[model samples]
Target: MKHFAYISLCLALCLLFAGCTRTRISSFRVETPEAPEVEGVHAYMEPHSATYRFSGSVTISPKETMAVSGSYVNYSSDSLMQQSRSFSANGYYEFGGSDVNASFDWFGKASVMLIGFGVGYDDGIYHHLKVGFNTSVVEAGVYLGLYHQYTTLEINGSTCDTWPCSERDNWGSMSETNTDFYTNLFYGLYASIIIDDFFMSYNLSIYNPSVSGGGESVSSPDIYSHYIKGGYRISKHWEVNAGLIMSFVDPDYRHFAANVGAAFYL
Candidate 1:
């Protein structure tokens, strides 16, 4: 009951903050680089900006006995635009020294990341044209991270649960597709609220691709997956962020992770 209420409150705050944008602002970062006009590509980049980065996150998933991960994120705003980018990696290994560990530990260092570069437009809109990739010596693939934000919101949720989990077979297998590959390429809108250097960000994403035994195919409409991340700033260069990360897909994975990092000027 508390989880449900918290989610509702977060959504309300997001709606409230999203309406807090100014009709006419004095200035922004980055300039508009002219492009051939298109329907959904109406954004421009900002040049002068401040960039904040999170070093990495250590995550422990249910697949291996235990694993560790790291990530890098940069949030910046210039004279014309505000943009962000992130990259992450993880490695898992079995617990208790084992004689047959060599064959299994070989699958330790599997990772993926989103290299997102987008343009911020007027009226608090942005487009994320991102590049995603993963490689493990034998097999490798690439995909696009298509994301857009059209609103802002506030978030408040639980911080007590330390470890989250999914079903046994819900790692990343789709039931309605025939593709031998899997990746994260979600599209959605996000809302956030910032007050006195404290912020709450919530996002609702739609996974357009559903898979079966064969490959990826267009299927029925999915559910609204939720993500809420909030934190406090300790100084001009550092902040601590933590929250609940979950999904609403067939093979869903839920977990709690936090990051303590810094923001740098670029």
Candidate 2:
């Protein structure tokens, strides 16, 4: 009986060792959980949205390289018209806008280049001072800001030589219409809509003179026409912009321009 007890104890020890070995082998054979596949598409397209941010963007566009169409005609207060049909190279300097702010909100855009310098009836320096707030067409807000402009046109020899009046008569009145530097205080309703890579904005601004100086000084008008602009984001911080600017006077003025520039946010 004692011998049988010893044999039984040995069999129990063997069974315990076999069970532990089987458990160890089961753990080792388990395959590592497959690693998740990361996607790059979402990463590339995310920056284009309103939520996508930019630090700043800067671009330099020279007008000398662009072919200018149309001519500039200078008219005297004395009822004389002179025309110059020469190609002009003009400079455009604009800073700060809704898009500029939006760009930096995500990343950033910075540009340091000569915008354009043209020899048209254009003001040597045409500036746009706009204060606006906007959301998706789904959201709209009102903003008020000053739109100031300093424009100078050198009397073209071809146009000025044919003046109907003497040099003195031409000089006095010609100076009035040739160069204009005025600032308009405008409060307006602005709205924007974003579709794909394009964005469009409409602003109906009431133009009033905040600082009336230089040029033909006249009391501000009661009302002015509305302006509309549309732009497309070509790259991270680069955009192609175009717009129509108009005003009412004895003779209404309408200007259409297309330009490429960089927008920067603060």
Candidate 3:
């Protein structure tokens, strides 16, 4: 019953937006490299421009939910070691709960190939934040990002539902579908590629929250997610993307997701 409702919501959003976008990964080797000098399948590519992207996704795991994401990129320039920067926001909505995040990054400089900060929120409950850094080198025409995230989920509760399985306690005020609150420090990696009007990306991220309630610390197991997306430009300013997301806490708690979205260049 709960899964059905979430699925319905995700479908409705897809119909409403008919839009596209994907999460941007940091790569020290490239800042959207310049399109080939020759014209053909990759002629529409532009290396020194700005863009805004948006996407919608569905989580198919411990529970079902609808996730939406958007991002903004600043035009590349010669200043600050070939400067490139971007800001992004994303969220997931399920019955009785939601989780959202905002992040920013600046790259194109060797001394600081990748610098980023982000914040996470679960409706009006726990508060969370993270900071990270990464560097990458081009390999076989793709740029990979090597990064780390330090995250903290802080709230007054000693108990809450963390996902993997189900909640065991009736802990006061904890919604049946809220992301577990905890603090964690972990590393991850990412990759991206651009070919003319085509684009693709992949990411593997880590999350583990440690919390305290009743003077006792509640430690949740580590969570990992694998994400991949592909996109194609349909016009000078618009692109459509689709991908899969897999997340796991354990063999007993693994899930899959699919997403579709668009990107708009400015």
lDDT (Cα atoms) of all candidates against the true structure: 0.29, 0.29, 0.36
2 against 3, candidate with superior lDDT: 3
- lDDT (Cα, tens digit) per residue for candidate 3, span 1-266: 66456545644664577621222221111011001000011112223322232322232323443333334453222232333355343333222112232222222222323222222222112221222222232211112222222222322322322211122433333212223322334445555565656766666666443333222333334556666767787888566767776666556655565545444444
Measured on C-alpha atoms, candidate 1 has an lDDT of: 0.29
Best by lDDT: 3
Candidate 1 lDDT at 128 equals: 40
- Judge candidate 1 at residue 23 and give its lDDT: 15
Q: How large is the C-alpha RMSD of every model relative to the true structure?
A: 25.9, 38.0, 22.1
Prediction 3 global C-alpha lDDT: 0.36
- What ranking of all candidate models by lDDT puts the best one first? 3, 2, 1
- Per-residue error for 77 in candidate 1, Å, reads 57
Off by over 4 Å in 3: 1-187
Error of 3 at 92 (Å): 19
Worst 10 residues of 1 by lDDT: 98-107
Q: Model 1 misses residue 242 by how many Å?
A: 0.3
TM-score of candidate 2 relative to the true fold: 0.33
Per-residue alpha-carbon lDDT of model 1 for 121-226, expressed as tens digits? 3212323442332222111212223222222211111111111211221222112112122232345544445566566655554443222111112122233345
